[model samples]
Target: MKILITNDDGIYSPGIAALAKIAAAFGEVRIVAPDVEQSSMGHAITHSRPLSLKKSPIAFDGKEAYRVNGTPADCVALGLHIYPDTEVVLSGINMGPNLGNSMWHSGTLAAAKQAVLLGITGIALSTPVGKTEPDFNAFADYVKEALEVIFENKKLGLYNVNFPPQPKGLRWTRQSVRLYDGKVVPALDPMARKHYWITVTPLEQAEEGTDRWAVEHDFVSITPLRLDLTNEDELKKQLDSAVELNKQL
Candidate 1:
């Protein structure tokens, strides 16, 4: 398999290196990623400016590599366009998790989403933050297993995989649905200028089987994400209601 690897954590992050090592074991690898961190950038592309790329060698076993001055989505776009034969696109071993509602704003997930839009299979991998820091080597087995299942199921579309701090095993999970207590903290800089920092405190879910719950319980969460955002149930209901109202009028 020809794998195209990309990430939102920039080209030099250890997370990407770990991911590259795992990908190298599968087949020939090619990496195209941002020259700098593009975290939380979502599926943004370099629309206004001419996107540029340059060769930036890393310690991966990839056959070719490039660094882009663009978002993670742009990296995947360029990688697929440049290497038209790429069979799979793997985005991240992101330093942060892209779970629940966060996937909508995660550049890591956006890379995979972009690849899927281009009619290619893609997966996004992420690890949780913990006090022990990361030991990527420990995640090799879990990462490889996720790849195995993904490869076997080509029609799975976009997948978001998040490993717990210490993974016990993997679980197919649903995305969590809950609101966050997002706050904008105010602070003053040394120059006495007031600035605001946005922070999130996630609300607890009583429900299990969600990505967030699985991860919190030491399980690797794999949620199959889709490009289609249509809520078909609501759509059908609203359409029916409209038709009934028209008949009454």
Candidate 2:
């Protein structure tokens, strides 16, 4: 089995390095990640500028590695388009957690989504949420266990996996039905130019049996996700209403 490893946290981040070590246990691993942190870039691809790929001597326990001047999605796109035969695409082992509403804006998860769009199996892994300092060391074992479960299941599709700060165990979960409480922090530069950074406050409430709740309760969260955004039920309902309206029109 050949696995392609990539992340939004840049090529040299410890998170990606640790992920590479674990992925190497599964197959011949190839690393092609962003040269700089893309973080919450979502599923954006570079269209305004050309992308650059450079071979890197950086080895994941002697595995081949490369860096790309692009977003996380770009890495997977280039990887599959260039390699064509890669069996699995494993993204992240991200520095910060991707849970709840964060998945919508995470480049880490976006990379995996891109792989799924290309007809390949993909998994996006993330560490627990934290403040000043993130404790990635505490979640290393959890990551290993999650990878084992993921590798054993061939039916798994594009999805997001989030480990708690130090999970007690694992739990299959559904996406949180709650939304984010967001805020923007105001700041000023020396030149008195105003700027704002979007900051996530916290969910006011979370329904039970969700990924957010699982993480909060000290369990690793695995939420199966898909790229399809169509609301089939709503679409059908609207179509029925349209038919009714056509009788008068």
Candidate 3:
């Protein structure tokens, strides 16, 4: 299997290096990522300007690695073009977790999503961070296990995976859908210039069997995902209404 590894945390991030090392066991692994951090960039593509790929300044376990001057999605686009036979695209081992609704704007997940959009299997893996950097060596085995679980199921074209610092086991999970309180806090810099910071807080507790709950309970969470955003139930209701209106006319 040919695997393309990437991340939103930039080319120099230890998370990507760690992932590349483990993924080498699976297949031929190549690293292509942003030259600088592109966290929370979502599934954005950079069409306005020409993008460039350069040899990584740092080595990734001696893997062939390149850095791109674009978003996480752009890296995947260019990487797949360069290696058209890539079978799987693994994004992250991100610096932070991408659980729950945060997937909406997560560049880590975006890289994986891009792969799935281009008709390949894509998986995004992440873990929570604390005051210090995560000891990735401690969770190396779990990373391998996560890959095994994802690969065994060929039907799963896309997945969002999250691991607790020390996972007891793995669990199949669904995306956590809950309400949140979005906030914009104003602040002043040392120069007394006003600035604003946007953040969010969850309003409800995580539901059981969800990605958030699985990770909270110290299990690796793997949530299968799809590209479609359509609400089938709502579509059916709208179609039924249209039929009734047509009959009345």
Candidate 4:
């Protein structure tokens, strides 16, 4: 199987390197990632500037790799559009955890979402933050186990996997039911220019059976994320209600 690996954490990050190394054991692996960190870029694509693809000698266990001057979504777009032979797309092993409502803003998950849009299976992996550098060994093991499960089941959907600072075990999870408390911090540049930085503050509370809760409990959270956003059931119900209201009118 041809596996295309990409991440929002740039091509040189150890997270992606570790992911590439582990993925290589499964099949032919290729890396095409952002030239620089594109972390919270979400599913953004570069349209204003021309994208550049450069050959990178940076190898993860001697696998072929390339660097792209674009967002994580752009990397996946370029990979599938240019290399149609790619069977699976693996995003991340990201430095920070992507959980709860944050997944909507994560470039790591965006890459996987892009792959799913292109009809290829995708997997996104991430590790929680810590005061010091994160240990990639355990996360790599989790990735390996996830790969085994995916390969064996074949029906396992695209996943958004988030590992805690030091996960104890893996748990199939659902997206968090809670919302993020996002804020903007005002600051000034050295030149005395005013600016604001968007910051995410964790909520003081968490609901059970959520991705955030799973990670907090030291479980490697694996949430199946689908590309389709249509709420068919809700739409149908609304339409039925509208029809009844029209008759009453």
Best by TM-score: 3
Could you give candidate 2's per-residue lDDT for residues 58-156 as a string of tens digits?
Answer: 767777788999999999998887788898899988878788888889999999999998888899998764565456777878888888887787874
Which 10-residue window in model 2 sums to the lowest lDDT?
128-137
Please give each candidate's TM-score: 0.95, 0.92, 0.97, 0.92
lDDT string, candidate 3, 126-216, tens digits = 9999999998998899999999988987764999999899999999999999999999999999999999999999899999999999999
Instruction: Give the CA lDDT, 0 to 100, for residue 196 in model 3.
Output: 100
Checking candidate 3 for backbone clashes, the offending pairs are none
Which regions of candidate 3 fall more than 4 Å away from where they truly are? none
Q: Please give, for residues 204-235, the per-residue lDDT of candidate 1 as tens digits.
A: 77259999989989899999988889999999
- Prediction 4 global C-alpha lDDT: 0.86
| Model 1 clashes, total count | 0
Comparing 2 with 4 on lDDT, the higher-scoring candidate is 4
Q: Number of the top candidate by lDDT?
A: 3
RMSD from true fold, candidate 3: 1.1
lDDT (C-alpha) at residue 134 in model 3: 91
Better of 1 and 2 by lDDT: 1
**Candidate 1 vs 4: which has more lDDT:** 1
- Could you tell me the C-alpha RMSD of candidate 4 in Å? 1.9
Q: Summarize candidate 4's per-residue lDDT along 46-132 as a digit string, tens digits.
A: 999999899886857777788999999999999887789998899988988898888889999999989888888888989876786
